[model samples]
Target: MLKSMRENVKSLKWVLWLVVAAFVVSIFFIWGASGKLTGDDAGNTLAVIGRKKISGDDYLQALRNRIEAIKSQYQEIDRAFIEQLNLPQQVLEQLVEQTLLVEQARAMRLRASDEELRDRITSIPGLQQNGKFVGYEMYKRVLQYNHINLSEFEHSLRQDIVLDKMIRLLTAGLAVTPDEVWSDYQKASDSAGIDLLILETSKVSLDEAPSAAEVQAFFEARKGAYLIPEKREGLAVFLKAEDLKKEIELSEKDIENYYQANLSRFTNPESVRVGRIWLPFEGKDKALVEAEGRRVLERLGAGGDFAALARELSKDAKASGGGDYGFYDWQSLPQPERDEIHRLTSGQTSDLIAEADGLAVIRVTEKTAATTTPLAGASAQIRSILLDEKARQLADTRIAKIEKEAKSARSLETALRKAGLKGESTGLLKNGEAWSDNDPSGAVGTALFGLKEKEVSAPVYTYTGVGLVELRKVEAPRPAAFEEVKADVETALVNERKMETSRARLAALGRRLEEKNWEDIAARNGFEFKTVEAHKRDQYIAIVGESKTADDLAFTLPLNEASAPFDFETGTAVLRVRDRKTVTREEFENVKETQTAQILNQKKNMFLQAYLAKLKQEKGIQIKYDKFLQLTQDVLSRYESAKQ
Candidate 1:
């Protein structure tokens, strides 16, 4: 019975299956080995959770899998973005959380049966076709495509199922009460009308500038802020692959070899230019919606203009634009939709297709048959590829030879001169600054800063090519003279004075609330009065800026009452609530189920977070951040090398 049910259930979509594969493979890479320390003198442990130590090989492989996953999403992934996300620390933290949960699951004696694991694998949509499992060979092919081992994938799947079962046990019976549901409904449905007055700092003027003594004092107090940054002077010899492309020559054999190796790249998939007319149900009876869809299709079949009919009767957002969905590859659409579309010839319309939310009619305006480029037709592209390959090889050889000579010579400049290459001087650069205007990659600067005076660096790869750098000089930061920054100090003091004046005026306006009309006060104080109508908590109030402080105050203040001055980026706002509305009982009842589900989910998430935190605290989970970072650097080095 379980196998039959699993076979009937739809498998996970391909994209989701790939994500699961990546995550599962990463876990195996972290803990798949014999659970023993190996190789490293400092021990191969990357982290320890409870009684288990996560090995370096596991962590490195996990990191590599993560990089590959990221690369799939982003075409131009870089080190800076990776560092910004602090991915290594994030991955380690996730592993630690998983370990805590798995340990707790084991303590509770929770386990997943082999049948359950098999059922789960068979249920994935990516491994199924035509409502049936695609057999073991196909399943293995899917795993191979995702770079996952069959045994390891099954092991991770078993662990995931166990963890899920444990989580379900922990969160079972969680519910939302009537009061909680009512409170959530009110918050979601409430809206406020507000009157606002804004004060702009730019409009406020100061009477006097700061004296020389005051300016000097300000500079003295913040002298470190004005210090000159340290600078470096260096010479770099660069070799670019593209520059060497003109020197290298490609033959017919090379072109044919490239073409034969990458035939898939030269093949074009079949595509259809498609247009759609969507009729949304919009709470209508399903039978009525289907009838309306059929009526539209009949009209289209009987010489009705698709665009005109769509503009007149279609409820889709793109109705006015003729409901044109444009060109699409066959594989890009859902299987059902693709099957329907494929049966139609160009300029033919399909019947009313019942979809999840509504009904759709598809029209194929044009079709392009799939074709593969012949060797003669693909010669130009292949030649370009071979040329690039040859250029890179030659450039790499040249850079290696240059690096060897630079290492043996007294100076990089001497080596470059001997090799008939001219080295460019960067003149001066700050520690964190680029070595040259053209060196935006910062590889040269990074290499130069790490070197001592007169020291040369190994070849560093940049966007342009490879670079060899020599450190010529280093100048440490020093405090600047007061006179040099006197103007800057004056400007700062003036802005501070203006801000004080603006605040005083705003406060005085706040104090006169009861006696004066807000509109009259705005006229008297040179502030503009604006009204915001029926805005919810999350909605942006244009008059009061995008800040939520005004929104919160509007809801909290009594109707027909003014709020204290709220400060935002543009300036300060004084707000008054004009009206407020709460959700009606009938309205709340209509969405009670949805609200309950949302609240229950929120409670579950909170409980899970707190559970993880408590488990970490109880287990005394200790992380060596330095070790994680070093491991990350080593993994990134390997990733970069693999890419090259």
Candidate 2:
């Protein structure tokens, strides 16, 4: 369909326009077309996506924005985890894709109309209050606070709208057939039971231990494997948040100021846990719905079970769970319900209330009045906060001075002595070794390793507080002594032999599997034989664990036919399908429509992705690898510097 649409562009233009009209009413957010195309700066261009160039600054800003977004999700996000995300590559890919999409929209003359743009902006939940736009002034102020240019933001948002329009236009022709849906449903629902023999590698033993000659030969062959990394020695002084508490002093005025500044921290809003039995007015007599609401209220008033009645009679989605809406902050409950709830005490039922769609009888199972801790009551916590804040400030000042002194004196010991502070000796530590768990990203080691012998480092943030490190000594990497690595070499040799023996044993068992009873064969070979209950093909098999190989063999192998040995990280396994379960005709029919919709959506995504790839190829996307690497290093370095 995509190929046909591309080949007959003029004929399908009207059809695509009609599809675009149909889509505008449903999708809230959409991609926009290109704005202000600029020539690429050779030195700064990160990538060229067709005519539009993504500059280094643009990539950095986008990367920072993405990091900020991720920070909100992970409270304790660290550099190691961020690096693992490989976000530089991902962000660049996204920018290139977005640019391609915007260009495509421009070519097709697909644009977001002024009215649609206005609707999209106003409908942004952050820019609205109580389901109405907060007006242009407040919206502008909010954007200003976040350092966003109003025009730039809108253009970016418009680009998103146009990009989405182009994608939807392309994918609109894709379809999923009823037969395809049924096939997908059956594939996902099919299950199998299997007898598995897992030969534990750890339990496998070598027939005999390797001789000293063998160990020596292995060590000689891989001497670099036992090479010790360069080590550093240093005297380090640590400052902790708690250590500076003695120097902190707070006045009553200080506590009061803090209490006012952080008022929300001390305030607890009033809330109610409400349970409701709703009788909808739709497709039923209004009077009958009102009568049902009254009956439910009466039952609750007479000390009857509210949850039981709600489960039996309520038409709401929460009916199965006893119609509990959990807790709602006082200001969040809608008008009539809020007023009625406030009047009722805990355990009291509300009178039949008329709602737009239904009559509801709500019960207040619990209520908590709003509270703000008095200044006097919060004084202790306030003092603690003030002390921590002041201590950190003091630590920063002292560390800054120490860093200067250490740099000038060229000795951490001299600097500490002059400052009347004692330092602890960090006995020689190897490069890449974790000196402190709080410094998991190994910033301290990186700083120290980059220094010459006897050189002191700038202040390093250690999560707990701030400190400085000095490279007192440097040990060059060297091959390990025979005695020093004897135990390690022996262990490695034994483990390797065990693995080799396990493979051979499994192979022997595989050769005899068809001729012998599985249990008897496994027991004779010192392997464990087990059977897992029937489970879907995708489901985790506790006995077999998580092996795609095992799963495939269990389902594909004929019943009573044994499988050959399959290797796993921890063990080796042979499997036999004992029983098989397939999706029933009734089961397939029950979810046929839902399965069809899911398959359609999946097909649409696949088509869109392939279309984008083709477009990208045609546009001749080019990335400057050296510049990309420099940008990645800059991002990581900035992050590290910020930690310091």
Candidate 3:
């Protein structure tokens, strides 16, 4: 189970991507504590960080919140799948980091006052009605309806305020020096061309055959890799939500009640949806910026694609979305831009509008009038929503009953019989194997592999609905005999030899690279000799694909100097710097200010991450292993006492 859990957590590459993507977004999701840990809470603590104690209950809530967030990205995610992904631990790590950041803020004497917290909460778009806070009672009701505890949410929000303050305090003064700007400019503008000697690993052949002893030795060295994965056989009872939905019958009263109770959801304000192409005039000449904006507007007038042009030239972050600014409330927008959008009809383009920062051309895509959805018009949608809600409620009630019975009886089949549900037999399935398409969330696989023989699992939710599993048998992986895997061993040996031979040949070629002509050496050795045209730092190489090592060598290696053998996926290769280009001082000066600010922001982010990593290392996180194990089992429904 641990091995499977580890497999599902994202790799380091994904973590790095998240570091950039969530740098700002992360502040919102970090649920924090009140900094008042009592002895009672400490008894149930999952982890300790200095004076901070993360209780089991807090951890559970954090895990639940994290699961809901994950569900937004993966609609089919359920309890079993969450367990498989080791999300409980992931959430714990996040909480620990939040604690650390909060602690640092307090140490720095940063405080989020009650007024600030109140302002922040009232300012939230969800908690507002017509741009006004929906009073105290309505606020509590809204939070309750969403299953958010008011106190916990407030505390978490307060911590977020503190963290934001600290981040601003730390990064506000950071700026790139003149030398740093020049260095970044060089990296962006410089290009390099390389002469290559390539040896394809697949084409390499081994004339000599390995002895029996060598093959045996290779197999022995990698015995664990050769073992078959563990498998499990189980019985399960699944209830599809769609099937339950078919049985639900919504009355007219139900639709009316839902409409009345959730009137805010049915209200629509007057709004305009516009696509904008903004040209900023911060660093560039204002005349040039306006000229470029006019050219783009002229292209639009001549039937050019708005979205395509936006993607190609717009400077806004939403440029990737084809410059879509989305719908904005009629009153929220400012100035002549709003007036310009209001004047244009749907699908009509606006004339170039001047703003404080830049020139923008707006295209009005849609205009909506203020209105409330009447019950007669919303009946079909309300009925569907009520049907889904009631179906889920019924499903949860039934699953809870089944879980109760299974726990008391210790037999999933008997519990199914009591519930008048048929038990389906799952044939032996290896770890990580999906039983069927119905289990797209991998809930069945997660339940089956985590259970012991004759042990019944808690209610496992799947893409379709919910289910319970009973493990009947477990097949532990075992080592294969030498003769049984002889052919596999020989294949492995041959591949290893191919790599070794390619590396050896490349090493030999590297020695003569400076003495002989590159093409002559390549021709004599039957390797390909080619020159990759000059490309920027981020561009992909022709034969080598995209590689940081290759990029570094290309930019750093002196002209006519040969590089050491660099091993890429397809083969090994040596490169000689053939040509280079450097940007002129005039060109660098053109974008110096913009490049400096961009590089400074990137550097600050890197420094922040490195600082946090070092802080975490120095103040080591201590876990209460027994409590953590209990928490994991409790969350996954592994313990008999875990179910509601």
Candidate 4:
């Protein structure tokens, strides 16, 4: 799931990149988080050191526009690179960090006015053709086409400027010293040597056990390494628009009123009444399922119950319900389903229907006459519709109130009563079917997962439109108490015992071999003793790369020497190191470029982490990391809900 999320993040980034690239691409879905354009769109802001809202919409669009620019520059651009260029996370992080830095600059009384923002944007080397700032008309046109206005556009461009300034200062002192680089280079080329005397601990296990003192000491030494988790106390309230609709009481009078006022929404559509028959095929011969559909179709054509035939032969979800799908119009069934139905009349059943999953059988149950529904006729439905609308409005208002109430309540019981709702509590639960999709009580186990002792949840909408809910409390996560984890702990102990037994046996073998040699030990142990050739680091069977085993162990052996058997966690193995050698200069140079690039990247990343840490400290840049993460979560949650 985490891997998929990473991929999704990558995909989001690319989406921005693609939009930035082609002027021809009209993007609305991304700006709406995979939906049509919406109101909860994001915003952007630039500050000299104060809080300002940034537009999510502007940020997403600029991200898309950046891709367009890249594509225009490189005609052969691919989807992968565009995705890397458009990380929403990177954009958000950049937005927050830049906001912080700019705020710092502002706190010190820094000011970049309208003129500076414009000059900065236009002065971009990529944007300018002739030295002078690009024409505002051209800039305005691009921004307009990308679904943004002047101010939002300026906000993003200014953020880029603040980032450039802050980064330059923070990273100003970093350099790759010649001495350090040379030392790294020499180490990369060097080989380490070491020797070992194997003592196989696994060869013994009497659970003749550790003395009580030893066991107690082992547990005590590791006591502080374990811990409990932090729990939260919070309040939340959700106003589901759907739930609000349920309480809406629409009277006949109200329906009539609504129909009179909004007459268009109630008008009936041109519709077809239909039924079906299904058939299956097996090679060139008659297939069982299709044969059934054929038999039913034949019976229908020769005067039979269409619904009965459908019930017997149609392979559809509606088959058991006598294939009765209520009235449908042009917009009701998609074009394909509608077309098939449109081909039939009230008494007609469709021909042997051939579909990949199975053959289909269709018969028109009844044809709906084309007519305009009068307001009077649609009054009841209109009332229900209007009632739902009213209910939703009420639900929203009450939900907001309830959420506010929860925030200050001393307990869930108090909050629920005040909200005019009910609450239920449950013991700790693992995320599972009963606590997830199939949760019986529903409220306590569904929706956002992390929970603590007295936190409320955002409103969760029940599919039945019963109501929205909030989880009021949860217990903190902790190491399982002794009894709770007894089974697992026992399994671990048993495995340890088995390993000890094996290690002791190996230790005895090693001792005998050191005193007598491999032949006598192998003869008595009923195993073969063999030597492997001196192999390259990359050719090892057990360890990978230039690890301590490959580095220290492999290079230390004298030519043609037999080492004692070693105990690995899973088993015991003995090695006879035949030779030790270094990589020739020619061989090392062959892969030098790739190796150097990896080394540089590793170093750069380490430096960046330290640099950012220093900046946070030396500049006294204090952050409520938890609160900040909360803000990010708040924005994300709001964003997800708006799309829904």
Best candidate, lDDT-wise?
3
Candidate 2 displacement at residue 29 in angstroms: 15
lDDT per residue as tens, model 4, 1-644? 33533333322322223334331232221222222212242222211112244444434543544443443454244434544564444544444444455555555454456787767756644344345644565455445544555564455455445545555555566555544544455455544332223323333446565544554454455444444443222233334445566556666777677656655444434555565444445453557666666677677768888777667656666678777665532222223445677777776666764543356666676676556557766655555445544654465456556656765773545777875767543334434213333234444344425444455554444322223234444556675444444444454455566666655555565445444255566556654444334454433343222333433456566644545455555444555554455656666667666666666667756875665555445544322222232223222321221111
Candidate 3 per-residue lDDT over residues 519-541, each given as its tens digit:
88888898878787877786777
Ranking by TM-score: 2, 1, 3, 4
Residue 417 error for model 3, in Å? 2.9
Provide the TM-score for each candidate, comma-separated: 0.54, 0.58, 0.48, 0.40
Local error of candidate 4 at residue 482 (angstroms): 3.7
- Over the stretch 512-545, how does candidate 2's per-residue lDDT look in tens digits? 7775467888778788888777766666766556
Candidates 2 and 3: which is better by lDDT? 3
- Give the Å error, residue 580, model 2: 6.5
State each model's CA lDDT, in order.
0.71, 0.71, 0.73, 0.48
Task: Flag clash pairs in model 1.
Answer: 11-123, 11-124, 11-125, 12-125, 29-58, 30-58
Best of the candidates, TM-score: 2
lDDT of 1 by residue, 1-644 (tens): 34633332222234335445555444454444322223243467766777866667666666666665575455345666676777776777766776788789899999989899889878865555567766666677556754667776777777778888998999997878999989877877898887887786777877766788887887888888886667788888877767888898777887888778777656765667777787878899999989988789788878999988888887766678787655522233334556787888898888887664577787888877778879998887667556655665576677778778887885887788888999998777765566554467576877778898888876665545567788998878778777767787777767767667766777786567664368888898898777878878777767455777886787888987777776776567778788898779998888989999999999999999999999988887655433464566545532321121
For each candidate in turn, give its C-alpha RMSD to the true structure in angstroms: 10.5, 12.7, 14.5, 18.1
Off by over 4 Å in 3: 1-158, 161-224, 250-388, 425-432, 448-453, 481-567, 570-576, 579-644
